[model samples]
Target: MRCLIAEDHLLSRRVLKELLSPDFDCDIAVNGREAIDSFVLAHEAKRPYDVILMDIMMPEIDGMEALKSVRSLEKKMQIPSHLAVKVIMITALGDPHTVIKSFNECEADSFIVKPLTRHKLATELRKLNVLK
Candidate 1:
Protein backbone atom coordinates (compact mmCIF):
# COMPACT_ATOMS: atom_id res chain seq x y z
CA MET A 1 0.00 0.00 0.00
CA ARG A 2 0.96 3.62 -0.47
CA CYS A 3 0.80 5.91 2.53
CA LEU A 4 1.44 9.56 3.26
CA ILE A 5 2.70 10.80 6.58
CA ALA A 6 2.02 14.49 7.21
CA GLU A 7 3.65 15.86 10.29
CA ASP A 8 5.71 18.88 11.38
CA HIS A 9 7.87 17.16 13.91
CA LEU A 10 10.89 15.47 12.47
CA LEU A 11 11.12 12.78 15.12
CA SER A 12 7.48 11.97 14.85
CA ARG A 13 7.73 11.70 11.10
CA ARG A 14 10.76 9.50 11.34
CA VAL A 15 9.21 7.21 13.86
CA LEU A 16 6.01 6.84 11.88
CA LYS A 17 7.89 6.14 8.66
CA GLU A 18 10.02 3.56 10.39
CA LEU A 19 7.00 1.84 11.76
CA LEU A 20 4.97 1.82 8.57
CA SER A 21 7.73 1.33 6.01
CA PRO A 22 7.73 -2.42 6.28
CA ASP A 23 4.18 -2.69 5.00
CA PHE A 24 3.85 0.40 2.84
CA ASP A 25 5.62 2.59 0.37
CA CYS A 26 5.64 5.78 2.39
CA ASP A 27 5.87 9.47 1.51
CA ILE A 28 6.55 12.22 3.99
CA ALA A 29 5.30 15.83 4.00
CA VAL A 30 6.51 18.33 6.55
CA ASN A 31 3.29 20.26 6.62
CA GLY A 32 -0.27 20.20 5.45
CA ARG A 33 0.26 22.19 2.23
CA GLU A 34 2.95 19.78 1.11
CA ALA A 35 0.69 16.95 2.06
CA ILE A 36 -2.10 18.34 -0.06
CA ASP A 37 0.18 18.90 -3.01
CA SER A 38 1.62 15.39 -2.72
CA PHE A 39 -1.85 13.90 -2.51
CA VAL A 40 -2.97 15.73 -5.66
CA LEU A 41 0.21 14.85 -7.48
CA ALA A 42 -0.15 11.18 -6.66
CA HIS A 43 -3.76 11.22 -7.74
CA GLU A 44 -2.92 12.93 -10.99
CA ALA A 45 -0.28 10.29 -11.54
CA LYS A 46 -3.02 7.68 -11.21
CA ARG A 47 -1.57 6.26 -8.01
CA PRO A 48 -3.62 7.74 -5.25
CA TYR A 49 -2.50 7.11 -1.69
CA ASP A 50 -4.29 4.31 0.12
CA VAL A 51 -3.87 5.93 3.51
CA ILE A 52 -2.87 9.26 4.99
CA LEU A 53 -1.66 9.78 8.54
CA MET A 54 -2.27 13.47 9.11
CA ASP A 55 -1.16 15.41 12.12
CA ILE A 56 -3.82 17.87 13.23
CA MET A 57 -1.45 20.72 14.05
CA MET A 58 0.87 21.72 11.27
CA PRO A 59 2.15 24.82 9.50
CA GLU A 60 0.70 26.27 6.25
CA ILE A 61 -2.60 24.52 6.89
CA ASP A 62 -4.00 22.49 9.74
CA GLY A 63 -4.74 18.82 9.24
CA MET A 64 -8.43 19.36 9.74
CA GLU A 65 -8.50 21.91 6.93
CA ALA A 66 -6.42 19.64 4.75
CA LEU A 67 -8.73 16.76 5.46
CA LYS A 68 -11.71 18.82 4.42
CA SER A 69 -9.95 19.95 1.27
CA VAL A 70 -8.92 16.39 0.43
CA ARG A 71 -12.48 15.19 0.88
CA SER A 72 -13.63 17.95 -1.41
CA LEU A 73 -11.08 16.90 -3.98
CA GLU A 74 -12.25 13.31 -3.81
CA LYS A 75 -15.82 14.45 -4.28
CA LYS A 76 -14.80 16.65 -7.20
CA MET A 77 -13.14 13.68 -8.85
CA GLN A 78 -16.27 11.62 -8.22
CA ILE A 79 -14.30 8.87 -6.49
CA PRO A 80 -16.64 6.42 -4.88
CA SER A 81 -16.92 6.70 -1.11
CA HIS A 82 -15.40 3.28 -0.45
CA LEU A 83 -12.51 4.04 -2.77
CA ALA A 84 -11.74 7.47 -1.44
CA VAL A 85 -8.45 7.84 0.43
CA LYS A 86 -8.57 6.67 4.01
CA VAL A 87 -7.44 9.43 6.36
CA ILE A 88 -6.36 8.64 9.87
CA MET A 89 -5.98 11.76 11.93
CA ILE A 90 -2.87 11.72 14.12
CA THR A 91 -3.15 14.16 16.95
CA ALA A 92 -2.02 14.75 20.48
CA LEU A 93 -5.41 16.03 21.45
CA GLY A 94 -7.85 13.32 22.41
CA ASP A 95 -10.63 15.52 23.63
CA PRO A 96 -14.19 14.70 22.73
CA HIS A 97 -14.60 17.78 20.58
CA THR A 98 -11.55 17.01 18.49
CA VAL A 99 -12.63 13.42 18.15
CA ILE A 100 -16.05 14.47 16.97
CA LYS A 101 -14.64 16.98 14.51
CA SER A 102 -12.19 14.50 13.06
CA PHE A 103 -14.57 11.58 12.83
CA ASN A 104 -17.98 13.16 12.39
CA GLU A 105 -17.28 16.48 10.70
CA CYS A 106 -14.23 15.65 8.63
CA GLU A 107 -15.10 12.00 8.10
CA ALA A 108 -11.71 10.65 9.04
CA ASP A 109 -11.44 6.89 8.62
CA SER A 110 -9.84 6.56 12.05
CA PHE A 111 -7.54 8.36 14.48
CA ILE A 112 -4.33 7.73 16.41
CA VAL A 113 -3.20 9.42 19.55
CA LYS A 114 0.15 11.11 19.75
CA PRO A 115 3.27 9.29 20.95
CA LEU A 116 1.98 6.65 18.63
CA THR A 117 3.16 3.10 18.79
CA ARG A 118 3.36 0.49 16.09
CA HIS A 119 0.79 -1.60 17.89
CA LYS A 120 -1.71 1.24 18.09
CA LEU A 121 -1.27 2.09 14.44
CA ALA A 122 -1.59 -1.51 13.43
CA THR A 123 -4.74 -1.87 15.46
CA GLU A 124 -6.35 1.14 13.87
CA LEU A 125 -5.43 -0.01 10.39
CA ARG A 126 -6.80 -3.44 11.08
CA LYS A 127 -10.01 -1.95 12.41
CA LEU A 128 -10.34 0.04 9.18
CA ASN A 129 -9.51 -3.09 7.16
CA VAL A 130 -6.42 -1.48 5.71
CA LEU A 131 -4.59 -4.40 7.22
CA LYS A 132 -5.54 -7.94 8.16
Candidate 2:
Protein backbone atom coordinates (compact mmCIF):
# COMPACT_ATOMS: atom_id res chain seq x y z
CA MET A 1 0.00 0.00 0.00
CA ARG A 2 1.01 3.58 -0.55
CA CYS A 3 0.82 6.07 2.31
CA LEU A 4 1.53 9.72 2.77
CA ILE A 5 2.95 10.95 6.06
CA ALA A 6 2.03 14.60 6.29
CA GLU A 7 3.66 16.19 9.30
CA ASP A 8 5.73 19.22 10.19
CA HIS A 9 7.88 17.66 12.89
CA LEU A 10 10.92 15.80 11.66
CA LEU A 11 10.99 13.26 14.49
CA SER A 12 7.31 12.55 14.14
CA ARG A 13 7.66 12.02 10.40
CA ARG A 14 10.68 9.78 10.89
CA VAL A 15 8.93 7.66 13.51
CA LEU A 16 5.79 7.28 11.41
CA LYS A 17 7.74 6.31 8.29
CA GLU A 18 9.73 3.79 10.27
CA LEU A 19 6.57 2.24 11.64
CA LEU A 20 4.72 2.15 8.33
CA SER A 21 7.60 1.33 6.00
CA PRO A 22 7.18 -2.40 6.40
CA ASP A 23 3.66 -2.40 5.01
CA PHE A 24 3.60 0.78 3.05
CA ASP A 25 5.56 2.50 0.34
CA CYS A 26 5.61 5.82 2.17
CA ASP A 27 5.91 9.42 0.97
CA ILE A 28 6.77 12.32 3.22
CA ALA A 29 5.34 15.83 3.24
CA VAL A 30 6.63 18.47 5.58
CA ASN A 31 3.38 20.41 5.63
CA GLY A 32 -0.23 20.31 4.47
CA ARG A 33 0.50 22.26 1.31
CA GLU A 34 3.02 19.69 0.17
CA ALA A 35 0.59 16.95 1.15
CA ILE A 36 -2.17 18.37 -1.03
CA ASP A 37 0.16 18.92 -3.92
CA SER A 38 1.42 15.39 -3.68
CA PHE A 39 -2.13 14.08 -3.56
CA VAL A 40 -3.07 15.90 -6.74
CA LEU A 41 0.09 15.02 -8.59
CA ALA A 42 -0.25 11.39 -7.69
CA HIS A 43 -3.76 11.39 -9.01
CA GLU A 44 -2.72 13.08 -12.22
CA ALA A 45 0.01 10.51 -12.55
CA LYS A 46 -2.61 7.79 -12.07
CA ARG A 47 -0.97 6.48 -8.93
CA PRO A 48 -2.92 7.94 -6.07
CA TYR A 49 -2.07 7.07 -2.50
CA ASP A 50 -4.05 4.44 -0.63
CA VAL A 51 -3.93 6.34 2.64
CA ILE A 52 -2.85 9.60 4.21
CA LEU A 53 -1.62 10.02 7.77
CA MET A 54 -2.28 13.68 8.18
CA ASP A 55 -1.24 15.86 11.11
CA ILE A 56 -3.94 18.40 11.93
CA MET A 57 -1.71 21.29 12.96
CA MET A 58 0.56 22.00 10.02
CA PRO A 59 2.12 25.01 8.37
CA GLU A 60 0.95 26.45 4.98
CA ILE A 61 -2.54 24.91 4.87
CA ASP A 62 -3.30 22.82 7.98
CA GLY A 63 -4.53 19.24 7.82
CA MET A 64 -8.22 20.01 8.21
CA GLU A 65 -8.20 22.28 5.19
CA ALA A 66 -6.12 19.79 3.21
CA LEU A 67 -8.54 17.03 4.18
CA LYS A 68 -11.47 19.01 2.94
CA SER A 69 -9.71 19.82 -0.30
CA VAL A 70 -8.73 16.21 -0.85
CA ARG A 71 -12.30 15.05 -0.32
CA SER A 72 -13.46 17.63 -2.77
CA LEU A 73 -10.99 16.41 -5.35
CA GLU A 74 -12.16 12.86 -4.85
CA LYS A 75 -15.71 13.93 -5.35
CA LYS A 76 -14.78 15.80 -8.49
CA MET A 77 -13.11 12.70 -9.80
CA GLN A 78 -16.26 10.67 -9.01
CA ILE A 79 -14.53 8.57 -6.39
CA PRO A 80 -17.11 7.48 -3.89
CA SER A 81 -16.46 7.98 -0.21
CA HIS A 82 -15.94 4.28 0.29
CA LEU A 83 -13.43 4.20 -2.55
CA ALA A 84 -11.72 7.46 -1.72
CA VAL A 85 -8.25 7.43 -0.27
CA LYS A 86 -8.41 6.63 3.43
CA VAL A 87 -7.35 9.39 5.77
CA ILE A 88 -6.08 8.78 9.27
CA MET A 89 -6.00 12.11 10.99
CA ILE A 90 -3.01 12.28 13.29
CA THR A 91 -2.87 14.84 16.05
CA ALA A 92 -1.37 15.74 19.40
CA LEU A 93 -4.71 17.18 20.47
CA GLY A 94 -7.01 14.97 22.53
CA ASP A 95 -9.87 17.36 23.08
CA PRO A 96 -13.38 16.11 22.44
CA HIS A 97 -14.32 18.94 20.11
CA THR A 98 -11.32 18.49 17.86
CA VAL A 99 -11.69 14.74 17.83
CA ILE A 100 -15.38 15.03 17.06
CA LYS A 101 -14.71 17.51 14.29
CA SER A 102 -12.03 15.32 12.79
CA PHE A 103 -14.56 12.52 12.50
CA ASN A 104 -17.86 14.26 11.85
CA GLU A 105 -16.71 17.29 9.92
CA CYS A 106 -13.40 16.35 8.37
CA GLU A 107 -14.59 12.82 7.63
CA ALA A 108 -11.41 11.03 8.55
CA ASP A 109 -11.32 7.24 8.16
CA SER A 110 -9.53 7.00 11.52
CA PHE A 111 -7.71 9.09 14.09
CA ILE A 112 -4.53 8.34 16.00
CA VAL A 113 -3.05 10.26 18.88
CA LYS A 114 0.53 11.49 18.75
CA PRO A 115 3.54 9.86 20.42
CA LEU A 116 2.47 7.13 18.05
CA THR A 117 3.48 3.53 18.51
CA ARG A 118 3.49 0.43 16.37
CA HIS A 119 0.48 -0.91 18.26
CA LYS A 120 -1.57 2.22 17.73
CA LEU A 121 -0.64 2.40 14.06
CA ALA A 122 -1.49 -1.23 13.43
CA THR A 123 -4.83 -1.02 15.22
CA GLU A 124 -6.01 1.95 13.21
CA LEU A 125 -4.74 0.50 9.92
CA ARG A 126 -6.54 -2.74 10.64
CA LYS A 127 -9.74 -0.84 11.31
CA LEU A 128 -9.29 0.92 7.99
CA ASN A 129 -8.50 -2.46 6.38
CA VAL A 130 -5.14 -1.12 5.27
CA LEU A 131 -3.36 -3.67 7.44
CA LYS A 132 -4.07 -7.22 8.48
Candidate 3:
Protein backbone atom coordinates (compact mmCIF):
# COMPACT_ATOMS: atom_id res chain seq x y z
CA MET A 1 0.00 0.00 0.00
CA ARG A 2 1.04 3.58 -0.58
CA CYS A 3 1.19 5.90 2.42
CA LEU A 4 1.80 9.59 2.93
CA ILE A 5 3.46 10.69 6.16
CA ALA A 6 3.34 14.33 7.27
CA GLU A 7 5.35 15.49 10.26
CA ASP A 8 7.37 18.61 11.02
CA HIS A 9 9.89 16.82 13.18
CA LEU A 10 12.53 15.16 11.06
CA LEU A 11 13.34 12.46 13.55
CA SER A 12 9.74 11.49 13.97
CA ARG A 13 9.23 11.32 10.23
CA ARG A 14 12.29 9.10 9.86
CA VAL A 15 11.16 6.81 12.65
CA LEU A 16 7.71 6.41 11.10
CA LYS A 17 9.18 5.66 7.71
CA GLU A 18 11.47 3.09 9.21
CA LEU A 19 8.63 1.42 11.00
CA LEU A 20 6.35 1.30 7.94
CA SER A 21 9.06 0.46 5.39
CA PRO A 22 8.59 -3.27 5.55
CA ASP A 23 4.85 -3.07 4.97
CA PHE A 24 4.20 -0.06 2.78
CA ASP A 25 5.42 2.28 0.09
CA CYS A 26 5.94 5.52 1.98
CA ASP A 27 6.21 9.17 0.98
CA ILE A 28 7.43 11.81 3.41
CA ALA A 29 6.24 15.40 3.85
CA VAL A 30 7.89 17.90 6.17
CA ASN A 31 4.81 19.99 6.90
CA GLY A 32 1.09 20.13 6.36
CA ARG A 33 1.35 22.30 3.26
CA GLU A 34 3.78 19.91 1.65
CA ALA A 35 1.59 17.05 2.62
CA ILE A 36 -1.47 18.52 0.95
CA ASP A 37 0.45 19.45 -2.16
CA SER A 38 1.99 16.03 -2.40
CA PHE A 39 -1.37 14.40 -1.92
CA VAL A 40 -2.98 16.47 -4.63
CA LEU A 41 -0.13 15.80 -7.02
CA ALA A 42 -0.31 12.11 -6.42
CA HIS A 43 -4.01 12.08 -6.99
CA GLU A 44 -3.71 14.09 -10.16
CA ALA A 45 -1.05 11.72 -11.35
CA LYS A 46 -3.60 8.95 -11.03
CA ARG A 47 -1.75 7.34 -8.18
CA PRO A 48 -3.71 8.38 -5.14
CA TYR A 49 -2.31 7.49 -1.75
CA ASP A 50 -4.00 4.67 0.12
CA VAL A 51 -3.49 6.20 3.53
CA ILE A 52 -2.23 9.41 5.11
CA LEU A 53 -0.50 9.79 8.50
CA MET A 54 -0.95 13.34 9.66
CA ASP A 55 0.60 15.27 12.56
CA ILE A 56 -1.56 17.97 14.14
CA MET A 57 1.09 20.61 14.69
CA MET A 58 2.87 21.80 11.60
CA PRO A 59 4.15 24.87 9.77
CA GLU A 60 2.52 26.43 6.66
CA ILE A 61 -0.71 24.71 7.65
CA ASP A 62 -1.95 22.52 10.48
CA GLY A 63 -2.89 18.90 9.96
CA MET A 64 -6.51 19.49 10.84
CA GLU A 65 -6.78 22.24 8.26
CA ALA A 66 -4.99 20.13 5.71
CA LEU A 67 -7.31 17.25 6.32
CA LYS A 68 -10.30 19.51 5.91
CA SER A 69 -8.93 20.67 2.61
CA VAL A 70 -8.35 17.13 1.45
CA ARG A 71 -11.87 16.15 2.33
CA SER A 72 -13.20 19.17 0.55
CA LEU A 73 -11.33 18.24 -2.56
CA GLU A 74 -12.57 14.73 -2.35
CA LYS A 75 -16.10 15.95 -2.09
CA LYS A 76 -15.80 18.54 -4.83
CA MET A 77 -14.11 16.19 -7.24
CA GLN A 78 -16.51 13.36 -6.60
CA ILE A 79 -13.63 10.97 -6.53
CA PRO A 80 -14.37 7.62 -8.06
CA SER A 81 -15.20 4.59 -5.96
CA HIS A 82 -11.77 3.14 -6.59
CA LEU A 83 -9.90 6.15 -5.19
CA ALA A 84 -10.68 5.94 -1.53
CA VAL A 85 -8.10 7.43 0.83
CA LYS A 86 -7.99 6.86 4.56
CA VAL A 87 -6.40 9.38 6.88
CA ILE A 88 -5.02 8.66 10.34
CA MET A 89 -4.05 11.34 12.80
CA ILE A 90 -0.75 10.65 14.52
CA THR A 91 0.53 12.95 17.21
CA ALA A 92 2.10 13.11 20.65
CA LEU A 93 -0.78 14.95 22.23
CA GLY A 94 -3.14 12.50 23.95
CA ASP A 95 -5.75 14.97 25.07
CA PRO A 96 -9.16 13.42 25.07
CA HIS A 97 -10.74 16.61 23.77
CA THR A 98 -8.32 16.79 20.90
CA VAL A 99 -8.86 13.14 20.12
CA ILE A 100 -12.60 13.63 20.17
CA LYS A 101 -12.30 16.74 18.03
CA SER A 102 -10.15 14.91 15.53
CA PHE A 103 -12.73 12.23 15.15
CA ASN A 104 -15.76 14.49 15.06
CA GLU A 105 -14.36 17.44 13.16
CA CYS A 106 -11.70 16.02 10.89
CA GLU A 107 -13.24 12.60 10.22
CA ALA A 108 -10.00 10.72 10.61
CA ASP A 109 -10.04 7.00 10.01
CA SER A 110 -8.11 6.48 13.23
CA PHE A 111 -5.89 8.27 15.75
CA ILE A 112 -2.56 7.13 17.14
CA VAL A 113 -0.29 8.56 19.79
CA LYS A 114 3.37 9.20 19.21
CA PRO A 115 6.32 7.12 20.39
CA LEU A 116 4.51 4.46 18.41
CA THR A 117 5.60 0.88 18.86
CA ARG A 118 5.71 -1.35 15.81
CA HIS A 119 3.17 -3.68 17.29
CA LYS A 120 0.70 -0.90 18.00
CA LEU A 121 0.97 0.59 14.54
CA ALA A 122 0.73 -2.81 12.96
CA THR A 123 -2.34 -3.58 14.98
CA GLU A 124 -3.98 -0.36 13.85
CA LEU A 125 -3.14 -1.10 10.23
CA ARG A 126 -4.59 -4.55 10.56
CA LYS A 127 -7.72 -3.23 12.19
CA LEU A 128 -8.13 -0.77 9.35
CA ASN A 129 -7.64 -3.68 6.95
CA VAL A 130 -4.63 -2.02 5.39
CA LEU A 131 -2.63 -5.03 6.52
CA LYS A 132 -3.45 -8.70 6.71
Candidate 4:
Protein backbone atom coordinates (compact mmCIF):
# COMPACT_ATOMS: atom_id res chain seq x y z
CA MET A 1 0.00 0.00 0.00
CA ARG A 2 1.02 3.58 -0.55
CA CYS A 3 0.10 6.41 1.79
CA LEU A 4 0.59 10.16 1.85
CA ILE A 5 0.98 11.93 5.19
CA ALA A 6 0.34 15.66 4.75
CA GLU A 7 1.23 17.70 7.78
CA ASP A 8 3.30 20.79 8.49
CA HIS A 9 4.41 19.88 11.99
CA LEU A 10 7.64 17.91 11.82
CA LEU A 11 7.00 15.77 14.87
CA SER A 12 3.54 14.85 13.69
CA ARG A 13 4.82 13.91 10.26
CA ARG A 14 7.52 11.70 11.76
CA VAL A 15 5.08 9.98 14.05
CA LEU A 16 2.60 9.34 11.27
CA LYS A 17 5.29 7.95 8.98
CA GLU A 18 6.48 5.65 11.73
CA LEU A 19 2.98 4.40 12.39
CA LEU A 20 2.25 3.72 8.74
CA SER A 21 5.66 2.45 7.72
CA PRO A 22 4.95 -1.15 8.67
CA ASP A 23 2.14 -1.48 6.17
CA PHE A 24 2.60 1.26 3.64
CA ASP A 25 5.25 2.75 1.47
CA CYS A 26 4.91 6.33 2.71
CA ASP A 27 5.39 9.73 1.15
CA ILE A 28 5.68 12.89 3.20
CA ALA A 29 4.32 16.36 2.34
CA VAL A 30 4.86 19.23 4.73
CA ASN A 31 2.05 21.35 3.40
CA GLY A 32 -1.19 21.07 1.51
CA ARG A 33 0.23 22.30 -1.79
CA GLU A 34 3.00 19.76 -1.64
CA ALA A 35 0.46 17.10 -0.83
CA ILE A 36 -1.57 17.97 -3.89
CA ASP A 37 1.52 17.92 -6.04
CA SER A 38 2.50 14.53 -4.68
CA PHE A 39 -0.94 13.25 -5.47
CA VAL A 40 -0.74 14.33 -9.08
CA LEU A 41 2.78 13.10 -9.54
CA ALA A 42 1.99 9.73 -8.06
CA HIS A 43 -0.87 9.22 -10.46
CA GLU A 44 1.26 10.31 -13.36
CA ALA A 45 3.82 7.77 -12.26
CA LYS A 46 1.16 5.08 -12.14
CA ARG A 47 1.51 4.66 -8.41
CA PRO A 48 -1.34 6.61 -6.92
CA TYR A 49 -1.62 6.63 -3.16
CA ASP A 50 -4.09 4.28 -1.56
CA VAL A 51 -4.72 6.64 1.33
CA ILE A 52 -4.02 10.19 2.40
CA LEU A 53 -3.95 11.52 5.96
CA MET A 54 -4.45 15.26 5.62
CA ASP A 55 -3.93 17.88 8.27
CA ILE A 56 -6.47 20.70 8.35
CA MET A 57 -3.94 23.44 9.04
CA MET A 58 -0.82 24.11 7.03
CA PRO A 59 1.19 26.75 5.21
CA GLU A 60 0.12 28.15 1.82
CA ILE A 61 -2.94 26.02 1.21
CA ASP A 62 -5.12 24.69 4.00
CA GLY A 63 -6.21 21.06 4.00
CA MET A 64 -9.79 21.88 3.13
CA GLU A 65 -8.80 23.59 -0.09
CA ALA A 66 -6.31 20.86 -0.88
CA LEU A 67 -8.95 18.25 -0.27
CA LYS A 68 -11.32 20.01 -2.61
CA SER A 69 -8.67 20.21 -5.27
CA VAL A 70 -7.84 16.55 -4.95
CA ARG A 71 -11.45 15.55 -5.28
CA SER A 72 -11.84 17.82 -8.25
CA LEU A 73 -8.81 16.36 -9.89
CA GLU A 74 -10.10 12.89 -9.34
CA LYS A 75 -13.38 13.84 -10.91
CA LYS A 76 -11.64 15.37 -13.90
CA MET A 77 -9.67 12.19 -14.30
CA GLN A 78 -13.00 10.39 -14.43
CA ILE A 79 -12.07 8.24 -11.49
CA PRO A 80 -15.07 6.55 -10.04
CA SER A 81 -16.14 7.40 -6.53
CA HIS A 82 -15.09 3.97 -5.26
CA LEU A 83 -11.74 4.27 -7.01
CA ALA A 84 -10.86 7.66 -5.58
CA VAL A 85 -8.11 7.81 -2.98
CA LYS A 86 -9.45 7.39 0.51
CA VAL A 87 -8.98 10.59 2.50
CA ILE A 88 -8.82 10.85 6.26
CA MET A 89 -8.81 14.36 7.64
CA ILE A 90 -6.50 14.75 10.62
CA THR A 91 -6.51 17.65 13.00
CA ALA A 92 -6.22 18.68 16.62
CA LEU A 93 -9.70 20.09 16.50
CA GLY A 94 -12.18 17.45 17.59
CA ASP A 95 -15.13 19.80 17.47
CA PRO A 96 -18.28 18.54 15.80
CA HIS A 97 -18.51 21.57 13.54
CA THR A 98 -15.07 20.99 12.08
CA VAL A 99 -15.77 17.31 11.70
CA ILE A 100 -19.05 17.98 9.95
CA LYS A 101 -17.45 20.48 7.67
CA SER A 102 -14.75 18.05 6.69
CA PHE A 103 -17.24 15.46 5.64
CA ASN A 104 -19.88 17.75 4.27
CA GLU A 105 -17.62 20.06 2.34
CA CYS A 106 -14.73 17.94 1.15
CA GLU A 107 -16.08 14.39 1.09
CA ALA A 108 -13.48 13.07 3.47
CA ASP A 109 -13.81 9.36 4.14
CA SER A 110 -12.83 9.67 7.81
CA PHE A 111 -11.66 12.17 10.42
CA ILE A 112 -9.02 11.59 13.07
CA VAL A 113 -8.32 13.88 15.98
CA LYS A 114 -4.70 14.71 16.59
CA PRO A 115 -2.31 12.64 18.66
CA LEU A 116 -3.10 10.01 16.07
CA THR A 117 -2.80 6.48 17.36
CA ARG A 118 -2.31 3.09 15.74
CA HIS A 119 -5.75 1.92 16.74
CA LYS A 120 -7.51 4.94 15.33
CA LEU A 121 -5.64 4.63 12.07
CA ALA A 122 -6.19 0.92 11.82
CA THR A 123 -9.88 1.26 12.52
CA GLU A 124 -10.29 3.91 9.88
CA LEU A 125 -8.29 1.88 7.39
CA ARG A 126 -10.48 -1.13 7.99
CA LYS A 127 -13.61 0.94 7.59
CA LEU A 128 -12.24 2.35 4.36
CA ASN A 129 -11.08 -1.17 3.44
CA VAL A 130 -7.58 0.11 2.87
CA LEU A 131 -6.57 -2.57 5.37
CA LYS A 132 -7.89 -6.06 5.35
Candidate 1, residue 124: CA error in Å?
Answer: 0.5
The candidate 3 region of ten consecutive residues with least summed lDDT is 76-85
Model 2: runs farther than 4 Å from truth?
Answer: none
Alpha-carbon runs more than 4 Å astray in model 4: none
Q: Candidate 1, after superposition: displacement of residue 97 in Å?
A: 0.5
A best-first ranking of the candidates according to their lDDT comes to 4, 1, 2, 3
Tens digits of per-residue lDDT for model 1, 83-106 = 999999999999989999998888
Better of 3 and 4 by TM-score: 4
Alpha-carbon runs more than 4 Å astray in model 1: none
Q: What's the distance in Å from true for residue 51, model 2? A: 0.8
Candidate 2 overall Cα lDDT vs. reference? 0.92
Give the alpha carbon lDDT tens digit for every residue of 89-115 in model 2: 999997899899998888888988877
TM-score against truth, every candidate = 0.97, 0.97, 0.94, 0.98
- Model 3: per-residue Cα lDDT over 1-132, one tens digit each: 899999999888898899888888999998888988998999888888888989999999999888888887888879864465788898888899989988889878889998788887888888778888
lDDT of each: 0.93, 0.92, 0.87, 0.95
Each prediction's RMSD to truth: 0.7, 0.8, 1.4, 0.7
